[model samples]
Target: MEPVNGYYEASMNFDMEHVRPFLSQLEEAFSLGLDVDHLAKRVAEAEVETAYGCDLHLAFEGQPVNMKFSAWIDDIDAPDLYFYVTSEKLAEGIDAEMEKFCEAHGL
Candidate 1:
């Protein structure tokens, strides 16, 4: 997969501890068709710091798609996380999963 021009992003407030669980859910969401192994590996190797983020590579409809997940602490002392998906299809799936994740965690 190569690079493309499309992009989408979603964000919300969540505790830092939820980051791993959210990634796990994301992995499950993409398990059926998308090869997000790179993303999973990055998430596993990620280090917690003041600001951290990672990108995953995938192919959507033959187009190379890039997805990024990031987390940081906001000024109000709340943890904030965001994800960027370069394909609408990928975004749709991830968005749905994120909504469920947020609702389940009461974020």
Candidate 2:
């Protein structure tokens, strides 16, 4: 397996509340068996828009890895929340899962 040490970035039109569920859905799609509530609580406590950063761990094909992520409201007048992950593989997986989930859920 070609292990990558690069970062991936993406922005979305979502809110802080959507982050946890979206992450939970991605984990479920990958059969990672993670606790949604625990992930939610972690994200809820992260410092916003600062240098202190947050971490998100994910397993890809049974290999566990972590990605540092951060989220913030892009505009005070809008609900657009921008977020990004530091792992290339995890980011790619999340993008694919999100596409499938959005199509399935009509989002």
lDDT of 2 by residue, 2-103 (tens): 333555654455445566667678667776555667755555655544322456565667887665554453343223323355456666776677677567
Candidate 1 local lDDT, 43-83, one digit each (tens): 34445545557666766556777777665644323456666
lDDT of each: 0.62, 0.56
Regions of model 2 farther than 4 Å from truth: 1-5, 32-35, 42-52, 74-87
**Which candidate number maximizes lDDT?**
1
TM-score of each candidate structure, all chains considered together: 0.62, 0.57
Residue 26's C-alpha lDDT in candidate 1?
72
Worst 10 residues of 2 by lDDT: 73-82
Q: Name every residue pair that clashes in candidate 1.
A: none
